[model samples]
Target: MAHHFTAYEVEELLPELKASLGLRRFIDEEGNEVQKVPLGPEPLMRMYITMVRARILDEWLLRLQRVGKVALHAPNVGQEAAAAGSAMALREEDWLFPSYRELAAYIARGMNEEEILDRAMANIDDPLRGSEFVVYGHRKYNIVPAPVPVGSQVPLAVGAAMAAKILGHSVVTMAIFGDGATSRADFHAGLNFAGVFRAPVVFVIQNNAWAISMPSRRQTAAKTFALKGVAYGVPGVRVDGNDVIAVYTTASEAVERARAGEGPTLLEAVTYRLGPHTTADDPDRYRPREEAKAMEKFDPIRRLGKYLKARGIISEKEEREIWSEWGERIERIVKRCYEKPPLPPSVVLENVYSEPTWNLEEQMRELEESLEVMKELGIGVE
Candidate 1:
């Protein structure tokens, strides 16, 4: 029993759907401060360092994949500022529901390079234990494992925030997804529920202008992703995703608002994806190389470095030194991760059940026997 909307009702909703918010930007492409930055010298430098490491890590991930060291990766090449700025805005206790391309967010949340590499390399000690997906979840960091399905984590974040509200806790949850996810059912459900319940959560849409090979224009007819919040009775904010200061400023305000019981806000970070969707993708087929070249001027890492130089927080030489230093450290970490042992075949059933059934026990024994036989044959079964 589906009901059709009246023409009058559709007309009434059109005005609310109009794009109203302007993109919030603090710095220009040249790294000139166009607006007063909210962060001071020390914090700014720290963020810049994190952004650099994220870029370097992304570079290594691409290289490692090429050399067969890494199985697969969703590169965070061009969207460092969007991940770093918004992630750094959260408190230690706040929960982060991230996407596969949140390398910077993971780093900003204090996930060291070694830990990230371990997961990426699928080493024996990998937290997810060589799971099919390259998702991240860390109890110490209060971060949820990213779902492989697009936009699936949105409702989880909303539910967590609702629980916090009912418990009288000040925990605000933030979920980050890409532009393509805005069209998903989970995203809509999460936003509507958060709005109706006044849940303490923030929904960040990293509108990197593409959903894999699908351009954003094909994903939605809305003038802006932020405007999609209007129908759900949520406030929307548009920010420059390439500007770290701008993203941090807006995310901080949204976090504070959620902590104050003001409910969820839909934040749209407008930027470009300057790389392929994954290591298996080749952007050149669908995305114009000329367009990618043009986006280089808005490079987040270089833009931040220039801004820091202009502020006298770091010199040109210091910026180069920062890159060189982090690059060497990342090389060492990658070497260590490469040297790690592969997971044992028996670990597959370690956490599958509380008590193994008789059939399961028999299967485990068979597997053990097979491994022993292989070891006797010198087939590297151990």
Candidate 2:
């Protein structure tokens, strides 16, 4: 007897896999709940507010950098969804290992605005002592201090995941990096270890199309970064990074699988930076303005706004109010950041190590003496 094996037939004949992977949607862009999933209005509004705040913060930081108030700043303007979506999907106990450009993730994960701004301004109270400021850490929020070295966080994240498994904790570690970092050896090494050990980790590569001045096309010949995971025996997925729903759903599935001991997943979120690599770099030198303008049509905030308006969760007036309120709040934070004093010279030598070695102590003493001499010479250090 001959049997026809159509797509539906193949699915029916196969035993159900332990992993239950799928997408979920509560509302469409047209204001209708096509899937009829229950969702709280406040969370949706909060997501929108967070994205707007991130954009405002990026703009303000650029201006501050221009005025020499900050040493450097990396803006995560267009890739807000990749950060916010993955963050919102994680449970409170989950760990996050972020790269340099995750300001949106930090804010969404419950970082205090004042503290973040203070750190960016390199104030005396900055937790990192100014040497490191971009990657804000909140132990209460399960956020690890982001490392500045590209791709370094990958191994750290794998280590964290391994620790969670050894401790029998359900917590999963999510490491966020850019596509450029994917080309680095650390990226491959970390993924290989995680896959072999079945570590409870999710590697999120936010492909913003450029790693500084180099476009991703020039970075690698791979058809998609997600495909790189296959070599390490892990499942890889590419999603519309600008689609918050897609990112949220993909990350949610990956997290659930990791918690269930299924192993790590690699998600390549295809997105754009929408700004210069950092304050010190001029993107226009390498990236075309026309390309950025075209990418603006896929703004995650605008997409979410359309979804909210379609669902009748908010009106035009409510949306405007949300934007206006967040704008004012951001402006206030920017002013406060500028008003704060710079970090004291003492902090330069502090936190050099877990405990200061004799050599470090001597250096600190020398630094203090130099500062004193400078002060005597009428040279202000702050």
Candidate 3:
């Protein structure tokens, strides 16, 4: 049976029908500051540098992947501002739950390029011990590693926020996910729980227009991803993800609200993915080449650079120097990491248990025996 909506129900249940709303933006595509936001020169410079560094690292990772040096990469070519801007808004004590494409967020939190390269290469220095590919989690930075399943981190972030609230800790948790993740059960579950308990969490959706081969249009029937929060009784915010200043301002507000013991805010960052989803993807098969080219005008790094240049914060000469020096440094790091040896196969079995189980010990012995046989036959285990 279908239920009909009355006039009051229509107005209350469907607010999108009342009036059209636009995404918040601080800068134009031409890099002109259109709206002023309360961000200083220093952090603006830092965000720009972090975006550039992420772009360079993305390029090198793709190159390394093409040559079979790196295993895989989830590039953040055009979505740098969404990650860097929001990440900069968080306090040091706050926790970050990241999606796979948050390279700028990792860099913003002080993860160095060398460690990033080491993880990409799955070398001996990789903190994950080569168990995962390009999934980053750092204890010092209070970042939780991304899981392969989409939207799974949402509940985790909500749980952590509730725990903090109960313990009377001043910590807030932010979870970053993509538009595609909204379709998952975890997303709905987390948002509902957060709304009821008023969890101190900020949910950021980087709506980059594509979820692998699926476009954003097909992802949902809602006018905007942010509005999804309204159903859960959480306030919704939409920002221009390409404009660094706008993203930072909006995220900072949301973070402060959550830290003040208010309910979570659902933030939708409208942006585009200018490259393939990952090195394994071929975006050309789904999206047009012209579309990606068209998005270059709204490039986060380009827009931020122009804004900084106009204010005399960064000169053209300094911009060139930053890119060139960072590019060279990344190349050097890649070369050194590529030369490093991979961990032995046996190492995987070492960390699974405090004391080796009998079955695991038997398997280890069998693996050793097989390695000895291969060595005797002049066959490399690798």
Candidate 4:
């Protein structure tokens, strides 16, 4: 590479960078108009439906964790718009690599609540021997398994984008992670590689402000996570993660650019996580009372509903219906989850290979025979 610097590259070197693009909201939290709603009733309603489902499921999962129906969960209570809006921007052919808390995004990507419940339960019906964490993936959906190691999934998105480029496929990949991910090793390695190669990927940083107990101030010195991408030559955009319209517009632009053979873009969606980092942690210890109270008015669901109502897209009764419907659906699923058992031991052997190895087949046969003998002798399987 040449040592000579170009004006475009020098812009990144400036000491003082502008803070945020400001909160890109369509409606204030009080049901007042801020900007015109971006989509019609059908499209906007689709997002609303997804958000409600996500919220309902999120609440139930947390409840299940408390009751010991599930071992653990990462709740995405307040950040639904961040996931739905960004995910909705992608076409069916595009790929998604999401962090654990992006359940809303996974739901938006067409993952069924049943599958989500089964995964949470780690039951026999779950694919992958129930080893896959709550973070999910399906080849059909072009989603890869989220490795639970924080931001490690970023490079995979980069690699996939590069593969798409090499194969001349007009597909873009979106890597979604939380604010803390920006501080991790993979974040740097992946984004730097994507920038150099100009891979068709969008890095969606769900800046919900906390990585476990750490606040945003403790995460980085930079005013905005989006600016971190500027150093790698990736275009950076900071948006109101709470505003579905704002999130969709910026993510769509990035996707379009990627499909056009342009490089990656970094987006920082400013939002909040109203729940604990996961079911295992307690947020009250770290979160301030004032901050929590102040953020409620910006709840993504309420704000979006306000916009929808103002535009005559949906009414309160319809919203109530949506909630009631989800309530029943989730109730049915919870009941089913309770009746199911964990994955049978045999599935562990069978799932390892499309066809079990010779040794594995021999072992399985022996185990089944042993079980049968024990049952006949009045011995318990457990």
Candidate 5:
């Protein structure tokens, strides 16, 4: 008998053991029941609202990027449920270490819309002040700064988890990233150390099945990203990332385990990236539009809406009203962001040091004199 099987043969024989983790769902895409509801009415309503908010914001921001109102954006279009679900599962004071594409998670963590839009506009009121681009970090809420390189935040999350253990804090650090990041050295080191020390951290791999234009097959040959945890002696599980309730339940379980000193859990969220890798990427260059369009049928937001409607927890009229409310809110914040002036050039000198160093002082002096010349020339640069 032939030992090796082709991709098609593998799919035919063990369809669930593909490059991606098998989809787990409480409710199928057709609105038919698969298992018990993962959340009650109240919690379901809350998660639904957040998912819709994220979806609306993602679409609006992508439009802004296309029109040049925003500098760059990584759309989390089909991936909202995973971020929103996992983020809501976290308790207060627990640290969130996110990759560059986790805008939905930030929103669920109570990140103010004005600040996010301000940063997107790169305005004076932006907390990062251009030092960090996009929705990178918010130390106030304990969201660690997301480094540009994939999986860079993994080690940082592990370090925080280590610190939490030493300090006797019960906080579990959650590091969320794309599946591509799993191939990085930091991902291995982070999970390995977290396993060795039994650090309280949950590794949430938002497996969108694509790393830029590269498919997940090019990234790994393993049956599932979840199994990658076994090498580090950490237990892992796969969850239906599009099912917000499932993601929340899985994440909450892992977080609780970590808090109880049971060590880390590798949570591979099987989801899809419905847009380009970033504003700079062109999905059309590689993937087919028809394939992406086919994914629309399994959209997380649409799935949740169907569930809500089936349960009578939401009506079409009520849904439309909710959307209107969000639209007004986004419009008000965006207007404020646009009306705000850019930060004064000198503000750059403030955050770099405890006190101004000689080089910085000299640079500031030169800038001031240049600004004086510009002022005399009636040139505006602020």
Candidate 6:
């Protein structure tokens, strides 16, 4: 009996290729051109600044959480490349659907430091109404407010992509999520819907090895996170997440593919979470400290730094100056956030609804009355 293989069967039987194709490189850690991804001087400098700023913001916010100034914080310390690289790939008019831990994405998309710090400080002038809500919008930059709920932004990204398609626009939407989100139903649903509708959305999963305490192995039995896209009939790409050029190149291709009306693509960036999941978590409890230390050898910022230095885009003196300047900027922002006053009692009711419902109106009245009573008692609202 002669058996003929179908196209799908043939694809399944084909040998897997290394994930280095379509990547740009300038230098390797050993100061050699070992299949590097190249970046020009200006863009290289910009990437360095953006990555530093993201790290600084994460550190400051974690401090705020420790001091009880902020209720919660999710650190994106080690996942900067995944956020910054994909964000830099977007066109100015393109939209971004960000998960909670996307400080880099927001900053890269032109979110002001004050706006971000305000939200963290929960001040009266905070753009997103002092964290009473999650979405922080910068209408001019086309960056959507980040959603706090896990995997919720996936459908929103799909919807935005569909809208862009219907309007005959070339805009692409990138939905950023963590590996933990892949197990959720929304992940599957969003991918399936996007694939079927041929939506112009790129699903980027930062596979940082753990979903809080749970390891990636327990997250799924699948050999690779990228393979999940195969079930939805979209191209799935797994890239070295710590390789800034590789991450940028992969995301750039996916963005272009979506814009050309080809369809959605799933990019799994395999990176590591160096710090604890949040200020509230203790990584030592679940993962080994040695493993985290081992991952530091592949730090994206260091790798890019080496690449840029090797290409003469940046020198050791310039790197020191940049670090000093970033330190000053971070200190200034942190101080500003700490000095700002808390939100007023009235602000809590402002953005509760587009138009206040009767129930909301009643609640607002009650809140105001309670404040008035507190004032009578000579007590000030914090």
Best by lDDT: 3
Error of 2 at 129 (Å): 1.1
Error of 6 at 127 (Å): 0.7
Candidate 2 lDDT = 0.81
Residue-wise lDDT of candidate 6 within 73-117, one digit each (tens)?
777777888888888889999999887777777888888777888
| Residue-pair clashes, model 1 | 0
Candidate 6 weakest ten by summed lDDT: 15-24
For candidate 1, what is the TM-score? 0.92
Q: State the lDDT at 116 in candidate 4.
A: 82
lDDT of 5: 0.84
The residue-by-residue lDDT of candidate 4 on 1-382, one tens digit each, is: 7598889767765532342444566666666767775567777888888999999999898888888877789998899999999999999999999998887888888988887888787787665467765677777788787888889999999999999999999999999999898889999999999999999999999999889899987889987888888778787888889888788877888899999988898989999988889887887898886787788888888888877777787788887888999999988988897789878757656667777889998999998898899989999875
- Model 2, range 142-212, lDDT digits (tens) per residue? 88887777888898899999999999999999999998898888999999999999999999999899999
Candidates ranked by TM-score:
3, 1, 6, 5, 4, 2
Q: What is the lDDT of residue 23 in candidate 3?
A: 86
Candidates 1 and 3 compared by TM-score, better number: 3
Q: Write the per-residue lDDT of candidate 5 for residues 255-329, one digit (tens) a residue.
A: 999999999988889899999999999999999999899988878888888888888989989878888898888
Clashing residue pairs, backbone N/CA/C < 3 A, model 2? 31-310, 31-311
lDDT accuracy of residue 113 in candidate 2:
72
Report the lDDT of model 2 for residue 179: 89
lDDT, candidate 3, at 26: 86
Cα-based lDDT at residue 296, candidate 5 = 84
Q: What do the candidate models score in CA lDDT, each in turn?
A: 0.89, 0.81, 0.89, 0.85, 0.84, 0.81
RMSD of each: 3.7, 4.8, 3.0, 3.1, 5.7, 3.0
Provide TM-scores for the models: 0.92, 0.89, 0.93, 0.89, 0.91, 0.91
lDDT of 5 at 278: 90
Q: List runs of model 6 lying over 4 Å from the truth.
A: 1-9, 12-32, 132-137, 377-382
Across 172-272, the per-residue lDDT of candidate 1 in tens digits comes to 99999999898899999999999999999999899998888999999898788999898898888889999999888889999999999989988899888
